[model samples]
Target: MKITKSIAITLGLAGILAFKQDKEVPVKAALQAAQVHLANMAAANTDVTQYPRSTKKDGSIATTSSRDWTSGFYPGSLWYIYDYTKDKQWETLARQWTAGLEQEQFNRATHDLGFMLFCSFGNGYRLTKDPKYKDIIIQGSKSLISRYNAKVGSIRSWDHHTDKWQFPVIIDNMMNLEMLFWATKATGDSVYYNIAKTHALTTLKNHFRKDNSSYHVVDYDTITGQPRLKQTHQGYADESAWARGQAWGLYGYTVAYRETKDKRFLAQAQKIADFFINHKSLPTDKIPYWDFNAPDIPNAPRDASAAAIAASGMLELSQYTGRSGEAYKKIATQILRSLASSAYLAKANTNNNFVLLHSTGHLPGNSEIDVPLNYADYYFIEGLIRFERLNKGLAIVSTGGFLTVN
Candidate 1:
């Protein structure tokens, strides 16, 4: 936690060497480029009801309604820019986008309020200490916990996959538990914390294989409270390791460890991190293919979003990994450096103004393959900020959330 001056200098030199872009600082330059892209996106996406999700095949900005799981990321990205620049203009833009999701606080149908509300209003309240945002987060947490089945021991992930699953839970649900932790912290309620802990424990018990790679979906028997099916909804096959799913598991367990300080969670996070970092299929650049088991191998599409998420997660996990922390941070630096390169980072005023490119969303469903995604940009900016803070001997993240640095 207290980075020594010598260690800080070493980290800074390591980051610079990782990029090797002459005198250009990778984090600063990427953030400057991100600001331009975000400003352009804000101008182009004028409708508050719709959020930027990804780009269409025709190279246009594809959008989603506030109910979509990804709706919070764009606003969250705005908040990150504000956090970095401390500019009121970015704050205003962030607030306007965040305000649109206020009504989602009561929507009980989906388990993504953490992604939809916490990422937006949660960041807003953290930065500004706004009581209104705090209230929205509390209400949203209640809505999210409403989906928690006592018998199943996890929040239901999707309502539409009923025919294929009885009580379905996805590994991505791990990301939602942070808001539950926030709820407990905000309201002094043990109920939210208990539910979050139970869900995380249940996931830890059933979601992971022996090797630490996770199944995307675990369909549980509602009556027996046991998994009936372990399969993939988006990956290559039932037994294959999905790239983004692995990232979610890695990131999610790291968060669990942070909130509860449970050594089990910590160990689980490290195992997942090791599985990902040491995977045989991972490219030299640290950007993973869409699926580690994808039949195409080197011909498979690279998922920049997965790389971004894992890098951000590993940066946080690195702080807690003791002697392995440096190794974790080294791989994370490689990922961030790759993402900031010309191959992944989009040109100014191009790629529909999205900051990064080559993200794969729902490959089995044949959707949003190899496109620029908002969440990729969100986490890329977050990783840059975390790395910069780490090198400067500062706190890598605020206690309020995992994305921002103090």
Candidate 2:
């Protein structure tokens, strides 16, 4: 029973190896690690939160206070897990987290129920064929529809204390239209499709800069559906490209193209992807910084989350464009490899629970600026799983199944 230092180390290493072998490795192992991180986050803050935002001086998270309605990634995190694992535990957690958003959904002021509900319950229903989740998703989509202004032909972005701004449309809002499109398909309602199409068309007309990189925010005339100003709200300035916003535009456009087969959407997606891939701002590793114009090149932080999202979008794009997507496929694989090599935390280490690291949330405000983001972990694992599925030549599941690139 005498334990020497070398013997102790050998036994400990063996135990760890045994544990890892007992469980699944690769994507499943990474998913479990992400869940452990989420659990730790939930235990630390009585809130079973999805994505953690930066805190104010008053110790309050900014996203929690503002009704600006751009919170998308968190609940979507749970939905991603539920779909990947098909675990009832994840489904239960998704439901529980969604329950917290009931008041927000009923407010009739927020425009991102698609981000909040569709990514959570809308996805849940699609995967599990659960009627209750579908009901909630329908209600949430209707709430989002009520924010649409017929005069402006765009959904209102924020209804907070700003009475001066009306029909503010951010490029990021384009992603939310997916829920509306889903509502039209699920319920056979043409109104939802019309509204979604209107928003996409309006964004297409106003959001893109001459460089094909997009503006972060656009102000639309509430009365005549005219473009007032193209500004950058969360980016470096009114013109600089925010890396995450670009990923959103790329991913959103690809999804829109998938839904409508609108040649225009595919073209926009290609343009954005081209802009992103050819940008000088992209790091050698293929991961991008929070702002493409962030000064201090060597010291600039990498947003692994943005890379993960972009990788998934690029893979989707590869499937859309037959032979033209080869470059995107290569870039997507490079980004995923970089993430796995640098940011991914192995499951053997119990001290660090998060699967992916070095994700920048909001560097300007110094909020979760360079930390392991939950959504980063979620999307990294998702990209891996999807890549594996694609390599296996698996069919892309239409109903809550693994979405793969050809």
Candidate 3:
């Protein structure tokens, strides 16, 4: 009997991974467990062909399809695990998941293409040099820039009309700028880079408070291109600082500085980091509440995703800021340690196989109120990989991790 190409690939993936367990034993174990959990979840939900957005209370998953912003994270997680372990099976799974997301290349409705395309195919191209992935990313970047409003100097985050906001730009839009910068590098197109820079500068001017904590939404006047309202859509209050928004600001500007080598972005990133690290509301474990100013104080639900992203951003930020880099690295290390502990990291075959638990997605709106999210695990794995590289103290990071000046 002759096996088809698809059959052969399936057989190849059927073989268990031969994890080269080394100093990064905890992370290796986590990724291995994730593979098993993901495989089991897919088997249990035979109707679902791909990973969903997140798991709910009863062990059911959100059926949000590939068009959802979070659709990239599951594939991105597979890619990061592949990069960490060099396991062929991870690569195969990564390719499979990423392929399902290919249709999102032209999704122009949202400003999350960076989260959707770049995290999946961006990492895929980085590791494999797949020209196909490169093509998709360039096209996706173009689609992302289409949402940019030259008059507003920012990318419009939502298409829906609001009574108060004609053009709403959320802080989360900051995460999408990396794809534009990548497009500039991949295709030598300055248009993409310029739009990202303008968006970032405009966001910097309006989204942050004097102390650097960020608002969740900065609705701009479509005609004047100036910020109209400072409000919170997902936070505790309209005036309160949401934890994840601050995390996005920290990570976003870190990448901005890395791409442009602009000192202002670096300064902005550090200030956001300082706001987080010094805030009295941050937990002793470094995990932040769903809202920094949540009325409940210590009893507020913690967002592991925010901690994960902030720690990962701090790892890269550490390498940039000379002496202060060490302090940032220390805070990042503490956050990573807390996240890796039993309280957050899921046990083997638990939490519906989600990697990290207790990420509060949208508390005020009552969505994903303390469940595991795909993005949380994605950033945790990414943070661990960066931590391992940081420990190596070698220049391997400059290749796969962050940008550094000579």
* Candidate maximizing lDDT: 1
TM-score for candidate 3, residues paired by index: 0.90
Better of 1 and 3 by TM-score: 1
Q: What is the TM-score of each candidate against the true structure?
A: 0.93, 0.83, 0.90
Tens-digit lDDT track for model 1 on 1-406? 1213354344335544554653334887677778777877777767878999998878778999999999999999999989998988889889889889999999999999998998899889889999999999999999999999999899999889578789899999999999999899889999999999999999999989989899999999999999999997899999999999999989889988888989899899999999999999999999999999999989999899999999999999989877788999999999998898899988766898899989999899989999999899988998899999999888786426544321
The best-first sequence of candidates by TM-score reads: 1, 3, 2
Best by TM-score: 1
Model 2 TM-score is 0.83
Which rank order by lDDT, best down to worst?
Answer: 1, 3, 2
- Give every collision pair in model 1: none
Error of 2 at 199 (Å): 0.7
Output the lDDT of residue 128, model 3: 93
Candidate 2 wrongly placed segments (more than 4 Å): 1-29, 39-75, 161-164, 344-354, 397-406
